[model samples]
Target: MKSLFVTIVSLFSLSAAYAQTWSVDKAHSRAGFTVTHNLLAEVDGNFKTFDAKITAAKPDLSDAVFEFTADVNSISTDNERRDNHLKSPDFFDAAKFPTLTFKSTSFKKVEGKKYKITGDLTMHGVTKPITLDATMTGPVMMKGMGGKEQEKAGFKINSTLKRSDFSVGTIPVVVVSDEVEIKVNGEFAKQDGAVAEKK
Candidate 1:
C-alpha cells in the first residue's frame, strides 16, 4: 500500500513538471502566404497585421494549443490595383468578412522535431479543416542581446490547399491551378505569465 502511494505521487509530479505556455510576439513574428494569380503566375503575399496565442505541454510540441488571426485588410502583394481587386466581392470581400482565422484542434508529434497541426481555417465566411505539416526549431537557451533567455522557439508550416474547398474562386478548366501551395514561418517568444509556461 505504501509503495502504491509513492508511485502515484511520482507520476503526478512528472505530469506537473512537463507543461508550458508561450505567446506569439508579432513584432518579432511574421505571417505569409502565396497563391497563383490568373491561373499561370505565382504571386507572393503576406499579412502585415495578425495575432496569435500558443500553449504547449512540452518541448516536443505534442499537445500544443494555438490560435491565429490575420487582418484581411492587411493583405499585400506589393501592388495596388491587384490588391484592391482581391479585396473586392469577387475574392475576399474584406468589407464583409474582415479577418482570416485559424484555431488548432490537435497536434500530433512526428519524427524529429516535426508535427502534424490540425486546425480549422476560417476565411471569407467559410470555415474548413486544414492540416499543416510543421517543423520546430530551437527551443535552445541563449543569451539575449540584453540578457539571458531560455528556450527560444520557432516553427515552419507548409501545406497545399485547394481554394475551391472554401469556395474561394471558381475555375472553368482554364488558367490556374485550383490547388495553392502555402508556407508559413513563425517565431514565438515565451510569454511571461502564460499559464502553460510552466508546462
Candidate 2:
C-alpha cells in the first residue's frame, strides 16, 4: 500500500511539472467579425479590448484549455453612429452586459495543426455551448524584450453564430444576416515559470 501511494504521488508531480500557461500578446492579436448587410455587402467590425489565455501540458496542445473575455463597449465598426446604435437597447445593450466571455470545455485535434474547441460562451447574460475551428502555429522559441529566449504560438479561430441566440439584436434577419462570422487571430507567449496543474 505504501509503495502504491508513493508511485501515484510521483506520477502526479511529473504531470504537474509539464503544465504551462500562455498569455495572449494583445498588440499582435485581434478579435473581429463579419456579417452581411441587406444581401448587398458585408460589414466588418472588431472589438478593441479583449484578453485570452491557454493552458496545456503537451507540446501539441491536444489537451489545452482556453479562456477569453472581451469588453462589449470596445466594439467598433468605424462609424460612430452605428457603433452607438449597437450599444443601445436595440442591440447589445453594452451598459447592461458589459462583457462577453468564453471558457473551453474541450480541445481536440482534428488533424495537423487543426483543432476543434468546444466551450460555453456567455453574452448578454446568456450562456450557450459553441464550437470553433482553430488552426495553431508554432510554439517557437524567440528572443524577447530582455533578449532572453521565449516560447510563442499563434492561433486562428473561426466560427459562425446567430445573434438572436444571445438576444443581441432586434433587427430583422433581412436587414442584417442572422449568421455572424467570427474571426480571431492571436499570438501567445508562454509565461516563464507559470505552472498550471490539470483539474
Candidate 3:
C-alpha cells in the first residue's frame, strides 16, 4: 500500500512540474491603469511599451509567474500636458524612476476562468505586495510574419492598491483616490507544448 501511495504521489509531482511555462506576447498584451478624477469620472491610460513573462500551469496555478516593465515616458492619456505632468516630480518622476514592475508570488483559482494573483509591484522606487483578480478571456490562433503557426491565450486582470504604499501619494488625500485600479489585457504564447499535469 505504501509503495502504491508513493508511486501515485511521484506521478502527480511529475505532472505538476510540466504544467507551467510560457512566453508573453508583447504585441497583443497591455499593462494599463485608471484613476478617478475630481470625484466624478475615471481617467484611463496605459503604458505604450512594456514586456511580460508569464506561465499558466499547475492545476492550482501554484507554478505561475508574472513579471513586467513599462517605459515611464510611454505613458499615454492622449493629452500631452497631463501626460507630461505625470512624469514630473510630483508623480512618477520619470527621470529618476523610469520603469514600473510586478512579479507574482501566488495564484489561486476562483471558479472557472477566474483567478486571483498576488505579487510584488514596484513603482517610484518602492515595492509592495498586491493582489489582482484575473479572468481567462479565451484563446485564439495566429500566424507569425514568417508564416509560423501560433496559439494565444488571453486574460483580463483587475486590481486596486493604495498609491501611498508605493509612495506616489502626494495629493491633499481628500481629492485624489488613494487606491489605483489596474487592468491588464494579457496574452501568452505556447512554449512548444501545453503545461499539463495536475498535482
Candidate 4:
C-alpha cells in the first residue's frame, strides 16, 4: 500500500512541475507573410484574425506544444481586389477551406534562446510538414489592470514553404513565386491558475 501511495504522489508531483498554459494575446501577436509579386518585389500581408494556444514545461519553450489557426478570409494585402481574388478558388478557396492551421510535432532546443519547431501545416485542404526556425524571448513581469503582476513571453518564428505544396494558387514562379515566407510573432500572457514560478 505504501509503495502504491508513493508512486501516485510522485506522478502528481511531476505533473505539477510541468503544468503551464499560456493564452496568446491577439492584440500583441501577428501571423503574417511575405511573397514575391510578379517577381518584381515582395509583398507583405497579415491575417487579421487568429488564435493560438501554447503550453510549455520551461520558460525557454524547449518542449512546448503550440497550436495555431488563422481565418483564411481574414487575409489582407491592402488591395481589396487582390484580397478578394485570393479568397477565390484560384488561391485559398476560403469558402471550402476557411482556416489554416498548424499543430506542433516537436519543439527542440537548438541553442541559446533558439529552437527548431516541426509541425504540420494545413491550408487549402492540404497538409504538409514544415520546420520553423524560432526564437523565444522574455518572461517579463508587468503590472496588470488590477495591480497584479502578469507574466509575458514572446516568440519570433520564420519559415518558408512552396505554395504549390498546399495548392494555394496555380500561378507559375515567373509570375508569382511559388514560395511563401511566413513570419509569426507572438506574445502570450500566463493565465490564472499557473503554479509554476515565472521565469
After the best TM-score superposition of candidate 1, give how far the Cα of residue 132 lies from its true spot, in angstroms.
0.6
Model 1, residue 68: displacement in angstroms? 0.8
lDDT per residue as tens, model 4, 1-199: 9999999988767666666888999988999999998889999989999999887766655557899999999999999999999999999999999999999999998888888999999999999999999988877888878899988888999999999999889977888889899999999987777555344
- The true-versus-predicted C-alpha distance at residue 46 of model 4, in Å, is 1.0
Residue runs of model 3 more than 4 Å from their true location after superposition: 1-21, 56-62, 137-148, 173-175, 193-199
lDDT of 3 by residue, 1-199 (tens): 9999999998867766676566777778888888888887788889998888766554334457777789988999889998998889888899999999989998787888898989988899998888999897545678878999776667799988888888884985556677788988888876676665543
**Relative to the unseen true structure, what is the C-alpha lDDT of residue 162 in candidate 2, on a scale of 0 to 100?**
97
Clashes of 3: 1
For candidate 1, what is the TM-score? 0.82
- Models 1 onward score TM values of 0.82, 0.90, 0.78, 0.87
Q: Please, what is the whole-model Cα lDDT of each candidate in the order they appear? A: 0.77, 0.91, 0.80, 0.88
Q: What tens digits encode model 2's per-residue C-alpha lDDT throughout 26-75? A: 99999999999998899999999999999887776777899999998999
Report the Cα lDDT for candidate 1: 0.77
Please, what are the lDDT tens digits per residue for candidate 1 over residues 76-174? 889999788777876788999899999999988778888999999999899998999988887767666778675667888889888778777564425
Q: What's the CA error at residue 106 for candidate 4, in Å?
A: 0.7
Clashes of 1: 8
Question: In model 1, which runs have C-alpha deviations exceeding 4 angstroms?
Answer: 1-19, 171-173, 194-199
- Cα deviation of 145 in candidate 3 (Å)? 6.4
The C-alpha RMSD in Å for every predicted model, in order, reads 4.3, 2.5, 4.5, 4.3
* Of 2 and 3, the candidate ranking higher by TM-score: 2
